[model samples]
Structure formats: structure tokens, C-alpha cells
Target: MRLGKTYRKGGFMNEKVKSGSRNVAIVGPYLSGKTTLLESLLFVTGAISRKGSVKDSNTVGDSAAESRDRHMSVEVSAASTEYNGIRFTFIDCPGSVEFAQETYNALMGVDAAIVVCEPIRERVLTLAPLFKFLDDWEIPHLVFVNKMDRANIHVLETLHALKAVSSRPLVAHQYPIMQGEQLTGFIDMVSEQAYQYHPGAPADPIPFPESLKEEEHIARAEMLEALANFDDHLLEELLEDIEPPQEEILKDLKMELGADLVVPVFFGVAEQDYGVRPLLEALLREAPEPEATAQRRLKNIKGDTALAQVLKTFYTPQGGKLSLVRVWRGKLTDGIVLNGIRTGGIYRLMGQQQQFVNEVDAGEIVALSRLEGIKTGDTISTEQQAAIKLPKAAQLEPVYALAITPEKRNDEVKLSAAITKLLEEDCSLAWEQHGDTHEVILWGQGEIHLQVTLDRLRRKYNLPMTTHLPQVPYKETIRKTVASVHGRYKHQSGGHGQFGDVFLDIKPLPRGTGFNFNETIVGGVVPKQYIPGVEMGVREFLTHGPLGFPMVDLAVTLTNGSYHNVDSSEQAFKQAARLAMQTGIPQAEPTLLEPILRVEVTTPSEFTSKVLQLLSGRRGQILGYEGRNDWQGWDNVSAYLPQAEMQNFIVELRSLTLGVGSFHWEYDHLQEVPEKLAERVIHSNGNGGNGNSK
Candidate 1:
């Protein structure tokens, strides 16, 4: 009853079956007992002793500092287990939308998934994003209705709600046969057996539910009917009024589930461990095997065919970057160079420790050492086999940006190195210098992501950083063209008098034409030697126009100018040109231009109105909406919004739809920021200089 070891307990003494390899992803809504379920699985398989709880901070996974503090999974953690001769690599992915990208990454390279859902209808809404990810990838996945004893909703209604969000048919393979307020046990419709947990211990076994026979028969028949739809022979046998054999039904189930045609739902109370045994057996019997998947998706490289793909990446304190991968094909032996790339040490990971294993065969999740070049989605192929690309990992666009710099001027080199290492681990983050603002900016999935990278920089890399809101690379341009303006500068300090004059016209060029300068003074009133100086001065002033932002989309024409015999130096001419730029530019009535973005959002149709309201609140224009047939009750909505308004759209979009809707945006065009916002931005950027410069 104490989650006893498998072989020692008086459970079913099943024969040792030759179970193959399978990849299982444990995903669920926030605090829906996903980590607890994974811990229980580890315990039942003898991978660990007595499941560790999040409150205790001793769970097999959820070891990150943030995860422990929040008492929730913040990162995806994977571990392999062998139960009943089947090898399954289980990934416990985070449920929070703040870390939903991490959950999406875990879904890749997995054969099937166990989506944990809470019983409360609103509480269960958190699982919508996971369902959306499953839909996008078309990955075979099942739903596990967790917290049965504490759940307020009925099991049948919960299943119906779950089915409403799924594109594929969601059939119940297990149902609860409750006794009063207590869930006495569950009926495994697939196996046609009822299991009653030991009443005294709640985890101990007892006699099956006695009164659910008639109900179990109907549920079992329906489950079989669902399976029969996938197999022609099974359908024929069912039509002939014959009950299909257990073996045949299981085969059909595995085939249909692997093909992602149907998703089977099951009820469970993970806290009491009431429904774990049947789920374990179901995984062993019906979950897809690595060989079947490998055979279906193998490629021949040079010679040896190796089936492998990186599922996750961990930056360890001692071992550095450890790329966790599941080997699906040929054997990987020590000192054996499979491919010319990264011919080095092969390691196995157990939590934070890396165990040196001599060799790892197919179905093993091992970590490779010094894999500096290996990335999260890289396929580790053998020399003989052609590399087969795994399903693409999610590419998250960075939403929040911050200007990062070394706290100390001298630590710039170290800061650069730290940023590079951070980027290597998280390819989703982007960094570049804003050429217009001359400020370096770092971009990440959200504000927390950037903050975490900064934390890691100080903690792991010893690089203290300074953070500030990134400078917007604003531009200034004219609304209308202006004719020429004659300007001159004459000054006498004593030794030499400065005297120069120029005739200039500022005209509007096509958008994005940049700044262009021309000289039409054929008579050489302004000498050719000083002509270059005038152009130089105009170009320099364009960097910070009257509005203190870059000036563009304008043409400066030097039609005529006067020169002094002795004091008419290039410097004087340049000053004359700078004066000309100040006088002629104002006539154009330049306005500040801000960056606009084209945004695309995807959300369930039920939340369409909410998403529209969010867009409208952000001053976004709704372009159009298109619904994909494959995405159940979801529509892809596109819109155009100002980039400044999209700083936190990722977070807002998630919050608007109960952390279900998502969006992507990129720079589209430039629009004039209102005078109020432009003034605020200019003041914040230290642009409080004189109104006119000459």
C-alpha cells in the first residue's frame, strides 16, 4: 500500500513481456498534479522510493530554484523507466503559459502524451494551450482526468468538455464508479476490469467494483467499437457480432493511437494512486514502440544508421551543456565516431549527475559531453545512415527586449561571453545593436526570460549586468518637400574670420530611400573642394535631427553658395551647410515615426471576442480571421499593430484566453507616434537639447 516495489507486491504476476521503447510526455495544467503523477510513475517502476512531493521540495524533477519556490514545474525534465519490460522516457513539462514554450518543446520527439486536466471546468481551461500544441503537431496524445476524489465536476461531463476542445475523437477508456462522495474505484473500460483501491490505506488493492458490471459492459463495448473503427478486420469481427480478442483489440488501439486518429481519455486520482496500475499496463501494451517509429522515419546517412534527436538541453554547473537525447536506432558505443561532427564522449544523465556509460543502444536517453555545437533539435545520426530531421522544435519569437550592458566598463568582454553562452542554450532569444540608437538590445520570449538570462549571467558566468528599457530606433522625416534656402556663416574672433554661404533645397525622396545629397552648382560658387564638406555636414546632422532622432527619406540639394577668399575654409562651408540643414529642414514640418508591427494570433473560437477586445485595446487593427479545419474550435486571426503596443502582447494574449491564445508579430512599417507619446519618448532618451541647432 506504500507504493511498494513492483515485483515484491502481491499484484498481477504478469510474465516478462518484450516491451519496446516509447516516448511519453507528461503534460497538464498548472498544479494539476503532473509532477506528482510523474513522481508516482517513477516510484511504481522502482525508479525512486516513495514519491516526493512539491511541498517537500524533494521531487525527482521540479528541482530548479524557481520551480521549488513556485511549487510548480518551470522547466521540462525527462527521465527513463523500465516497467514490465517496456522502456519509456517520460518528460514532465511545465503547465504555466509563462513556460508554455518549454511544454511545446517537450511535445516534440514524443510518441504520445498524457495531458493532465483538473476537474473544475474553468480550472481545466488551462489545458487548452496544450491541446492547441497537440493539434498543431498532430501528435498522438491522451487525456488523464486527474484529481478525481477532490474534483467537483462529474467525470462524464468533464470528458465531454475535454472532447469539445479536441480535433480528434476523444473516447473514454476508463470511468469512475463512485460510492457516495468517495471515488471507490475506476472501471478500466479497455481491459473490462474494475479496480477498487484498498480502503484502509487508499493505495492498497481490494476487490473490483461489484455493482458496475452492467455499466462496465456498455463502456467496454463502446471502447472496443472505437478501436474497431480503425481496423477493417476488427470492424468485420464486430459486425459479425463477435467480441474481438484482447490481443487484437490492443493491437488496433496501438495502431490507431500511434497514427493520432483517436485520443483515449482516462480518469485517475493520482494522490491516492487509485488508477496507476491500469495506466501503466496500458502504456506497456498500447503506447508506440521506438522501432516502429524509427522504421517509419529512418534515413541513411553515410553508413551506420543512427536514430537519435535531442529532446532537451541542460546547462550544468560541472559538466557544462548536456544535450539530452533518446537513441532510436543503431547502437552508440564509446570512442566510436558515428558522424564526423562531434566525435567525442557519450554520457548518460541521472538528474544533475552524468554517469559515464560505455555504450547506449536504441531506446536509451543519454547526455553527450562537450556538445558545444549540438543544439536542442539536432539529429544525432550515424555515419552510414542519412540524417532524418525530427519534427521541428517550436520557434518562439522574442517579445520583450532590454538594453543590457556590463555594470563595469571593463567587464564588457566577459559580458559578451556570458550573453553568447546564454544565447547558445536558448536559441529563441535574439540580440543585436540598434544601429539608429547606437544601443545594444537583447530580446527574449518575455520579460522573465530576459531577466532569467541576466540572472544566469551573474550566477553562472560571473558577469554583473545593467538592464534598461531598450531605446527605440525612431526616425524623423518630412511631410512635404521644401525649396532651396540660402544660408551663410560669418564670424570674426581676431586671427581669422569665418565666412561661407550656401543655397540648399530639402526635397522628399521615396520612403526608405535614405538620405541623399546632390550638388548642382556648375559655376562653382561653392568650390568643388568644399562641396564634399557641405555633404559631410548634412549627413552628420541627419543622425540627430531637430527631433533628436535619425533623419531619413530626404534629399539635400546644394544649388548655389558663396565663398570667402581667405576665411572660406571647408569648416566654414560645413558650418554653412549645417545651418542650411537647420533652416531648410524645419520648413518640411518633420514628424517622429515609430515602428509598426504585423501581428498574427491563433485562439479558440470561443475566445475570439476576448482576443478581438484585447487587440482593440492595444490599438490594433483586425485584419481577418481564418479557421483551420484541423484546429477544433480555433481561428487564426491576423492584425496590424504598433510595435510599441506589442511589448507585452504575448503575456496579455495568454491572460486574455486563460493562457490559451498565442500570437506572433514582426516589424511591418513605420507610423507617426502621437505628439504626446513622441515627446515622452524623446524626453526619456535624454533628448532635451535646444529646439534649433545651427
Candidate 2:
């Protein structure tokens, strides 16, 4: 594949027009200055007249109202610019762990990623997951250590911390020239050229500093050694004490980066556009071309037919759906049919702003309007190539949930419609009309993720919602057996009188056995026809037990009963059965059973003890802990925790682990709630003390 042409003044003259595009994603932890870097890149490349700051909420990225309100990127924003002759589209991704699904989805389509991050060592751990993703997918990525002006540690220390998290080798592409605490300039490691920064202008060449010769030599030597690991010629020159040429070093960097063999690190203060120009120049020179990425991603599928995959989705207030898709193999023209859905319009995206484009070439990311059935991460192709599907990013399981209800009863009719659109926009979001609680629960990555979705619901759909912590699906079960309980129902009316009597034997079953019913009646005393009604009554009463919860892990038997032939009816027998349960259940010692989940919490090894303490504080039973598979310096702690204590567990876990910890959980079993807690729950539900049965 042809490499991207170098940048020249007044554009390329003799070289062929660079029609190929490079899709790169900017990602990092929260407050990493990704959006600011985007603004700087756009401004430096003349894509925008003036740079916009994220604090002012005027940056091209993070233009959504939800993002502006929070002053953080909550979704993926796409902006395209031309650096040199090559078209470069930057996908600015959210840094928050809650919005990682957005980052992962956008990352799948890009040729490379710029992992923007702070220079603080404490927060360096936050990039673990992101680095793992890039390496796992073999997507070439480079690190841009932003906010250098506020760096608390030496640059080498920051690099050391970052290296602990990434599996690949990290080579410093540039070394910072700091004066005390403030960043003034940087030295290009490959060229060994010193440059000073100027506000709103390109960095100018400067004489190499004599005072920092030793440090620069060490940093540059390390970079060359890392590149030499992949090139034998460079290795020979290094061992012989012969200096390698700059062009040879650049070639090695480009080749190693394109193959995802090494990660080049750069230093920058994106807020002031310091070190931004050099970062861009490095991207234009070394970042892999889209064709190289496509070759790796689509090696098996062979066709010239238009093929694309959606990286993000948007639902406009005008009731139109927009699918931001990456054109992988062929050109995508306006109004082309893909997967049986004809594209309504083709447009290029600059954040929320859309520009009409008749057609998009291969390797370009663009928005196609009114793709009704297409969703984020779905591969779209012509009918002949419909079978050619690309693997999408793994769907993130929701770690937080909220029980939601419409603020206005009239809006209830629109809730499902609105939430459907909301889920379409954010595939990480999920909703369910819960079977046990009968509540409409919205599940997402974290509190902020769901909040942004809620804001969109109110703003775009005009359906405001009232939300609260989701109720745990607690249940009640008996601990003892009650035998030979008798109940009678007799009512006199103008017509035939109602008369029915029943005898019941109720007992507790093994845990998780659920509800069971059997009849031991003899001589048809209760009559077979009325047995169905009796069972129905028992099940209906179980829907709400004496403790005001669904009853489980119990069985009831119809021992004996009598009924008058003329007065006996199904309804009468049902009432008789209900009466028997009311009299028998409380005597059987009904206990509140709360749902327990088997949770596996993954965190850095250093925080395992704190994680254990956190679990124990929440009444969790520790199962065990061991080093997590395939994750370096990480441990997975397994425990059983009550669902009630899980409402804010993620919030606490993230807070403790510097926002890098997470877990996976599933229903394990039902266990009795503590005596004190059970009492409080019963009283809070208005059942009082030992429940209404008493």
C-alpha cells in the first residue's frame, strides 16, 4: 500500500491527490483533554478558523446539550479535516468508563487511535482497559500525554506508570522541554530537533538545550532501541555505535506502528495547542492507512460491493434515524440500498453538524440518514454481500439500573416508543418491564450514562421521567410446615347459597424449588372440578404473600374438604382456598428471601484488599480471589452479594479503583434477609412487624 504523502506548503504539487482517508479515534480517561486536542487539530489544519475550548462548550466535539451541561463528552463525535493531502477523520470518544461502549464502538472502525491522557501518574491506571482493547484488536494506537502544564510527576515517571498497563512496548516519540512546572517546548526524538511553542502558531525550531543533553540522549536512545527490536539493520547500527539516519528511524516507526508492534508516546498541553502540531505530524507520517486496517479486518471477505459498519447512531427530534457508518470496502453513494433498507441521504459529520455529500469513498466515515433497521455495530452491505458481516465490539453489560416512570401519566403511552429510540442511539443502554417487580427498569454502564439517556428522552421525545433506585425482587417462603388447616366459606344470597370448605397442608420446599401444588383428597370430597380453582387461588395469593412479596420455595396440598352439591362453585372453592392460606402461612414462619447475585469484581491487584473490605461491608460473602486471566496486574474477586446492596455498588467500586474496576454478576440464589433488615423492609412496605398476616 502507498504511504500518505508528507505535508507541504500550499498542498501537494507534483504528487497525486490523496483520496484515501485515515479514520483515527481520540480516546482516554475523563478530563484528558481529548476534545481540546480535536479543536486544536481542526484549527491547526485550517478546518476551523478559531479553536474552541471544552470549558466554553463551543468545541466541535461534545456539541450535544447533555455533554455541554456536563462539560464532558458523553458520545462519539466525528470531525474530518485535511492534513497534507490525506483526508483525516477524527472520532472523539468519551473518556468516562460509563461511556466506554461509545469508545469501543468507534474504535472498531478506525485505522488508528490517539489515546489522549493526563500526565498524572495516579490516573495512568485508567487507561488499562482502553490499551487492552487496542492491543487485543491489533488496532495501532499512540499515547498523547496531555495537560503537561499541570503534570505533577516527571515525564519518565508518567511513562513508567503508563507502561505498567499496556502490553505492547511504549517508545517515547517526543521529549518535553519543561521550565520548572510549565511546558515550553518538545524535542522530536527521531530527528533530534528542538522546537519552541508559540500560542496559535506552529512550533519554531530552537537550538538543542545543553543542560538536558543526558536526559534527551537517554530518551532518544530508548526510542531507537524500541524501534530497532523490529528491524535488524537498525539493531546492527545501534550495536556498532553508528548513528541511524532520521529517514531510517521514521520508516521503522511507521512500520512498527502500522503493525501494532509498538506504541509511540508524545507529550502535549492540548488546551494551549502546545505539542499539538507535532502530534498531528506524527499521525500523518506513521499512523496506518485505512486500507491496511481493512486488510486486517476484512481478509476473508472478498468483494467490491459496498460494505460498511455503523460505529454510532443518532435519532433526531424530527423522527429520523442517522447511522454513522465506516465505508470499509467500496464507495457508498446516496440512496443506495443496503440490507434491504435504502439510504435516505448521505452526509458528512462534524460533530452534530451534517454536510450533504453525494458519495463517500472507501475508508471514510459518514452519516447515512433514515437507516431504520440498522443499529450501531451492525454491518451493512448490498444484498449480494449481505452475508459479509464484520465482527462488532462486544456489547457492554449494564452495571447500574433505575426504575423509571413517566412524570405525567399521559406520557406513559409514549415511554416505550421514546426508550426504543434512546436504545437505538446508545446500544449500551437497555430497558425491560421487569417480570418480578413489574417496573420499567433502565440499565446502563453507570449513573451518568443513564442520566444522559434520560436527558435525551426529555429533550428529544418530550417525555420526562421520574426515576428512583430499582426495587429488589424480594420473595417470601415458609420455614415450617402447617398441617390440617381448615377454612370454610359460606355466603347466602337471593339465588343458590355459596358454600365450600377446604383443608390444606402447607410446607417449605428446598431453596429455589419454587411453588408446587398437589392434592391428596379422597372420595371426591372436594371434587376434581373445583381443584383447578383452588390451585389458581393459591397461586394468585402467592403473588403477594403475608410479607408483601411473591412467595417461593413452598408447596401446598389439598388434604380434604366438603362441598354442598348445589351450592358448591369454583369461585366458592377459590375463596375457601385463599382463606386457608391466610390462616396457615403466618403460622409456618414466613421469612423474607432476598435475591443474591454471584458477582466477580475485577480490579487492579493493589486494590484487592480494599475491594474485599467493600464487599464485606455490604454483607457480601467472599467466595475467593485470584489473578484475572489475560489481564496483567489485575485480580478478580468473586463474592455473593444481596441485590439490595448492589444499587450503588458500581459507583463505590469505581471511586475506590480510580474508575478502572468493574464486575460481572448473575442471579445465584435466594437467601433469607437479616432479621433486622427484613423487619425494616416489611414495615416499609406497610405490612408492619411480622407482616399483615399476624
Candidate 3:
């Protein structure tokens, strides 16, 4: 196959001559050279005049200002290039686990993915979650072991480490030829052909290396055996010791890879352009086309009208809203109305750059301008379609939170609109006004995730923020029952002065019962109208207990009360009840109740003990731990942890588990704060004064 010539900006193929397109994602762990791989791919394809480095911060991917400042990708960057007459659009996804939602959303629309990673054994575990996602979605993918020039381990050793994490069988498509410590070339496992790497040019075909004959045979046999699991003819040929034709082997690889049954592994140094051309060739030949992907993704929905799903939403400073969508079924033209909203324009994206296009064919990812109300992971279609919706990637739950306040008080009015747009850009981020604390809490996957969000808020919306760990919504509950507490309120300066008297019984209820109020006033001792005032006063006081938090799990009863005919109004009775509660609660042994969460932490088995220790250090009560279902060599640990200890838990957990550890938590029940910690909390909250503290 002949490679296509340089594709200039805005020089897209006409619809009449267009052969086909492939949407592929470049994904892996941070610092694994995914962006560098993307730069090499675009450079070798002649889409760009020169290759840009991530260190220089000029790569086609990671072009956002935030990414440049951090020297890492904060979001998914889409770039289009043509290679071998096939229009290829590569989505460069963030490698940080914090930004994984960006990768997951982009993966939903792609035909195939290239899982890029390093050859380090210790870092192989970082690919576990990514591989699981690809397999779970049945999205065909192959592995590209990057940075081979710096490898400290043998190629077979790297493959062995990778296979432990991936559920699918890994087939070595090529074996690297190393000279001293440097990678000189690779031998194709299928064809048994050798190629020498050359800078700035295609690889030169060479004779098979006789020194590697035995090693190559072993690796080739392993690849054939893995493929034979799904092919009876190949199994028979292998059993009979017959050499299969190169075309037949390639066909088997293509069939098995497209079915998500096997993962073809290749090795190369992306920065030097070694082994990239062969990788591209494999994709062009073996990767599933858009039509096959479309049939698998949209099998349940039948439609001829244009069907597209918003993979990512962007709020460009200049262009306004750009909804990157994958066209699934029909053609999309400029100004097409989808889901009752008319598109402002259509363009293909090259990182931050946009090239205006009049129309886009199905199976292509292009940005639709000014799509209001459309969100990430939303399936959109023409109005004539039968209201079809495509399944999107699940929104990841937030595991970290911060309380944010605008630097300028006047910006509060604009906060809601800005955050709405922010959430549209990243559905994984969540914000809420805490009902109890009344603080604006921003939630996300981790600290870096929220920091990037804050940076975006400052740069895009001019809403600079001050952030801190969010306050735990604590509650105070009585530990003992107090009966027959009497109180009186009398005020006199002139006629019709306020005067009232009340007797109350307060008792502790079971945990989680909340506030309960009742009255057993007999013989009209307290007027019916005044009884309601008494209950209201009790509730008002409960909002801020003596411990400076909302009170719960207690019952207050108005047994008897007296009111003056003219001076004893409802207001007078309310004040009397407040006096009674203020006098009685102190004697009832009020204790601080902190919210506990049922947390299930998932980590690689090797780190399970460390995770248990981490939980125990945070006053967490471990329930048990067991192997994670369907996840080889991973453990799921369940525990009950106080919400106060969870502010920095994700950061620590990731640090302990090489940035792959994750957990899910939900509110459990309220438990008493430890005695020493309770003192510190009360002191921080103004020593049991009127207001709560974060």
C-alpha cells in the first residue's frame, strides 16, 4: 500500500473520492509518550511540516494552555491526518488517572484505540484499568510498547508483565532487535522479515537476522497459538507443523483483533519514529473500519437520519461552544438541526485549530459549533429520526471535593453559569451548594483534576477562586434522656408584655431517626396555637446545636405549658421553649456525630495490605477484603470510614498504588467523633459557638 502525500490544512478529500476513515484514540498512563506518539504519527503521515515535542509544549495534542503550563494533557485533543489513502482521525487522550473520564468519553466514538505505554515492568499496572475498559466495551485495541530505546528489560519480559494486567491474550506482532542498550530494528513476527530503522524515512527492508532465529521462532509460535484459539484451520495447520501463508496469518490477526479476542503488541521509540510506520500499516490492514464499528455500536437503533454522539464538549474562548461528535449513520451538513438545535457550523479539529468544512460524512469526528444544551456523552440525531439514543460511557463518580469561593464577591452572580459550562465540558466534575454548610463545593476525581478546573475557571471565565477542603456535614445528637425540664419567659415594660411557661421532656432516639417533635398537653394548659410555636422553636434551635452543628436523632415533647390571656402569645411560648431546650441539652450529654461512609476500595493485590494500613490509620473500620471479580490480581476492600478522613484519601491511595487505586463511597450512618478529635473540631468551630466551620 502506498502512503498518502502531505495533507495540507483544509485540504480534505472530496466526498466523491473519499475511500474510508478511521477514528483511533491514543491512550495510556502519564509520561508514557502518548502525545509524542501522536506527533510522530502526524509527522510520518506528512500532516505537519515538523514534529513537535511535549517538552517544547508545541505538539498538535496537549495544545490547551492548561496542558502547556502543566506539560501534560488536561483534555482530549483531536487531530486528523491521512495515511495510505485512509482518512485517520486520532484522539489524543489524557494519561493522568485524574483525567480518565476524558479518555473514556472519547473512546465511546472511536473505531479502535492504540494503548500506548512504556516498557517498564513497574508501570505496567497502570494500564490495567484502561485495558479493562477497552475489553468491557468490546472496543478493539492493540498495545504499542513505547520508549523502547530506553528499555531496561527484554522485549519478552515487558510482554510478560503486560499480559498479567490485560484479560485478552497478547500476541507479539513484532520483536525488537537491540544492539547493546539501543534498539536497532525489529523483526515482523508474522512474515519473519527484518527491517532497519532510519531517521526521517521509512524503514529499510533487510534479511532476517540469523542470530535471532530461535528466539523469533518461539515468539512466532506463541503468537500463532494465541490466534489458533479462535481458528480451527489455524489450529490444524499448527498441529501438523505446516507453515501458514503470510496472508493467512494476517487474516487471522485481523479477524481476532476486530472481534476483541486478541491484542497485537508492537514495540518502538515514538520520539525517533522507529516502528511507527509498521504500526500504522497494521492499523490500516487489521483495524476495524467505521462501518463495522457502527454496526456493533448502533445495532439496536435503526435509523437512516443522521446519528451522532457528542464525545466531548469544549468552550473555546474564541469559537464559543464546539461539540466534538462522531457521525454514525447519515451525512451531516452545515446548519443541520439535531435534537431541535441548529448547528452553527461544522469543522474538523487539529488540537485547538479548526478547519471549516461544509459537510461531514458518517464515521468521522468533527466539531459542531454553538450546540447549546448538548452535553458530553449525549446522543444526538436529526429531528426526522425516531428519537434514538445511544449508550454513552458512564459518568465517573467524584472522589474528591473542595470548597470554593469567588475571589471577588461580585462574581458570585456569575458562578452558576460559569460552572454549568465547566460541567458541560467535563461531566465528571460536580458542584453543589452544601445544604448544611452553605459552601460551594466542587467535586472531582482528585486534587489535580480540581486544580485544572480552577485554572480553567480563571482563564476562561475570569472567575478566580479561593478553595479549601470542604467542610464535613456533622450533626450533634443527645446521648441521654432529660425529663420534666421547666422554663418560663416573662418580659414587662408596659401593658401587654410577653409572659409564658412550658415544661418539656427530651429523649434520645435510635441513630438516623432524625428530629422528632410531639406534644402531650392535656386540659388546654397550653393553647393549640401556642403548641405549634413551641415545636417550631425546638426545631430552630436544633439547626445549630450546642456543639455548633445540626442536631439529629432526638425527640422533644411539650408536656404542659401556661400562657397569659393577653401577654402569652405564640411568640412568648416559642421563647419559653427555646429557654427550656437551651437549659436541658447541656445536661443531656450532647456528643458530636460525624458522617461515616461505606467505602469499597479497589487496588492491585500487592498493595492490599498497604491499603488496609492506610484505612486503619484514618480510623476506618475494615469490613473485609476479597479478590475483585473478573479483575485478575486485584482486590476489593470494604470499610466504614469517617467523611472527615476522606478529603485527601484519594491522593494518598493513588500514591500507594501507582496512581491506579480507586474506590467508591456512599453515606453510611453517623458515628460519634473520637474524643480528642471532637475537641479539635469544637475548638475550630469557635468552641461550640453559633456557627459551623469547614
Clash pairs detected, candidate 1: 198-204, 300-385, 300-386, 301-385, 301-386, 302-384, 303-383, 303-384, 304-384, 304-385
Candidate 2 worst ten-residue window by lDDT:
9-18
Regarding lDDT, does 1 or 2 come out ahead?
A: 2
Best by lDDT: 3
- Candidate 3, after superposition: displacement of residue 279 in Å? 0.9
Across 611-676, the per-residue lDDT of candidate 2 in tens digits comes to 999999999999999999999899999999998889899999999999999999999999999898
Compose the digit string of candidate 1's lDDT tens values, residues 394-510: 677777788888888888867666777776666677898777666678988777667666777777877778877665567889888777787788999998899889999888777
Model 2: how far residue 180 lies from native, Å: 1.6
RMSD of each: 4.4, 3.1, 3.6
Query: What TM-score goes with each of the models?
Result: 0.89, 0.96, 0.96
User: Model 2: which residue pairs collide?
Assistant: none
Give the winner by lDDT: 1 or 3: 3
lDDT of each: 0.73, 0.88, 0.90
- Poorly placed runs, candidate 3 (over 4 Å): 1-19, 687-694
TM-score of 1: 0.89
